[model samples]
Target: MTQTAAQAGRPRTRRAPRRLPYLVRQLGTLVVTLFAITVVIFGLTAIAGDPARDILGQYATDAQVTAFQQIHGLDKPVVVRYLDWLGGLFRGDLGISYQSNGPVWDVISPRLGPSVVLVLFSWLLTVVVAVPIGLYSGVRLRGRRDASLTFLTLIVAAFPEFVLGLILAIVLGIWLAWLPVDSTAVSAGGLFDSPTAYVLPGITIALGTVPYIIRLMRANAREVASETYVRAAVLRGVTEPSLSLRHILPNAAPPVVTALGLQFAGLIGGVVVAETLFGFPGMGQLLAQSAASRDAPVVEALALMIGALFVIANLAADAIVVYVTPKLRDAVR
Candidate 1:
């Protein structure tokens, strides 16, 4: 009453603590991580031998090499080059690709589609399927159902993504001749050109993801199911499934959501292997080819882009957590 009366008498001096779950900390870490990525990527030039050699070849005369270096600004100090590159990055220029002789973004932009389609499809499928199965498995923890699920997940997770993709390619592409062995299906015309091409890649990514999400959800559900509220719900004539859906699932969401974010971010890298196996012309494929060709600018841009994506994914997860948990939302405020 006193506090309320005082607030009415004057503006309340104490504001609710400004909160947004872990957004502030995550943003700070993201900044530091991005900066570190820049530094590391820039430092790679030191070990890149010489751009003149990579670009012009050893057969070129010293005069030709010097001219090449000057024209491309390769002769500049590392810090100066990095600053120039960083400035260009902010202005939506990813620099010129040494290999393609065009703007890096222009070269990489078209390839972005396949990676986006593949990852989104994979992530959506993973969540849609894993969440329900995990919930059921969690409800049946330690029972035959859970045991079977655990074993199945183990088998799927045991194979590396590339291995699974390879086996699929051989079986679907070779033995049965059901799908294209290569990724020409997604080339140039986009995913609609050959929707079937997406099925194998999507399934490959899904197989890798399902096991991890299943494990996270199952563990979290079990922990939530054991909580007092769920126990009370069980006592009140509520079935385990109903209690799980109502009382346990929501409470178990934070960790699962967090893991999902990490998994999504990880899929960016995973697609590199997938693209390699499937021969899809995505950012992952471009990044691989650029790295091999010693196209430093392209590599740097691609690495930073992926890093930025990871930051975005983690931020999204934090936002979801803040929106869903009322107690957490209030505490943050």
Candidate 2:
């Protein structure tokens, strides 16, 4: 009759408690954020007046415009149209494009792959380059080398994506003749059709994102380096690499990870500019076309997608921070 037999007789065993409240709160926030994004995107386009009028132009007859409106259901009440649009979203209908006479998702789907590849490559490259530099700069603190790099990061970060893209295009593409001037990979064939063509756009995206990540990491490292544990390790004659890699970095990474997650949203803006500048047919390019034509549905679909991605990035960061930081994990649980 032992404890083992007693336990074996039970139908269930206790399981570890999940951070249910935290998860619920995050999900609630996500829904709110998505709703807000949809509203803003939809409202802004509506505010801009009818896309049918924009498409037809000023010289078009009133009859023609009204016919266009009726055909697209734009003649319905604004509130009714919005409600219908939302309903269609649940059925995977992203709405038809006013300009292209095609599904908005269909228009964006082809470009998504290249954008994913471009952004991911830049993101990885940013971390690879930023981390080591930030680590060294962080440890060096007040030294000349650190100050110089910090100043340089500031200057580079100040430059907009298009400006940097132009500079890189001029230097690497025009002068050196080393790579293609523009990302015409898809037009030429496929993304891998020309490795050289992809490099410039990737570089364009990385430059804008890298500086902030580096600066954030540097700040976090400096703060972590001052922690009591780090000071004690230093006094114990711990090797610098061991102290940095083992103690300081592990403690410092949570904040840097959070900052990195925020940069994903910033990257979307950069993508818009860089993609247009480099002629990369990503969401940015599509966004430009949609905006120019006042294609409300297309714009709404893209805006919502980007907004969801931004929210997801934040959720991921929260999850990562909670997982990696012992204090947060205990608190949340």
Candidate 3:
């Protein structure tokens, strides 16, 4: 009985140790990521010109600027300011905007939704269109069909987002009149309210990502298609759709998922120029305004938010890769 009890206790003891390492690693990653973000935020704030002057204007006296800086704790050491910022971040207080004189979250949170909506719609559209086309091109190999598709993808990919955004704005918004040209505000008509406003932006974002996904999917599918397993299945008269979807796509998913996560992270920041050009009110636009106004708190908060998003997205991708590829999980074990 004592031996059995000891054995039972051993399992619990071993499990605790296993968990400790995982916890340690997670904490370490958080610390390192936060430290790096702090450095970047500080550097950006320093180069962005005097926040006090930006807040008070050029006509403000030197004493006024100095007093403002002192009141805001800008007179403190950089390390102290960073620590204070980090502490505030932990407590969900992102600080006030010097320009807006409002809570940072209040200003940024509203715009975040619009940006997310745009990116999510674009991402879904890209995936839906790219996957099948990429699979088709890969399965067809060097055929005329594949060559045609590849050429088209390259052409589309080569086009810059702004250029595409302009062409789309003119073609769809002006000539076709399918969407609004300059409107960026979301309406009570819901997501489908302003096709003129949202459609072109969505399409531009989607188009920017499509070529990358198509290329990645095509390469991965082609490689999987050439594998012995796929060849065996083909020889056995396996149905094309089933074989591609079940056997091919699943195996080719790791890199695709990785690319998708990275693109999603990039979309968070990349939407700035597109959002600005289109007059969209999103986090990107907010960041642009904050930077232009030298709203240090808002700008720093936005930078940290974007950085956190990137890190989280990467972590999510890693988890997904491990989940899908047992080999990876086992390696970790």
Per-residue CA lDDT of model 3 for 280-301, tens digit only, reads: 7777778888888778898888
lDDT: worst 10-residue window of model 2: 261-270
Ranking by TM-score, best first? Answer: 2, 3, 1
lDDT by residue (tens digit), candidate 1, 1-333: 999887789965688666554667777878898888888887885468567776778798999988877876788887798899878877988888777778888888888888899889889989999998898788776777778889999998999998899899889889999988777668857467887777777778888888989998998888888888788888899986678788889888778887787788777767778887788888888888888888888888888887788767766777677767787777666
Q: Across residues 168-235, which tens digit of lDDT does each residue of candidate 2 receive?
A: 99999999999888686765677666766668888888898788888888898999898898999999
- Best of the candidates, lDDT: 2
Error of 1 at 315 (Å): 2.9
lDDT for 198 in candidate 3 is: 64
All candidates in order of lDDT, best leading = 2, 1, 3
Query: Against the true structure, what is every candidate's RMSD?
Result: 6.0, 7.5, 6.1
Query: Which of candidates 1 and 2 reaches a greater TM-score?
Result: 2
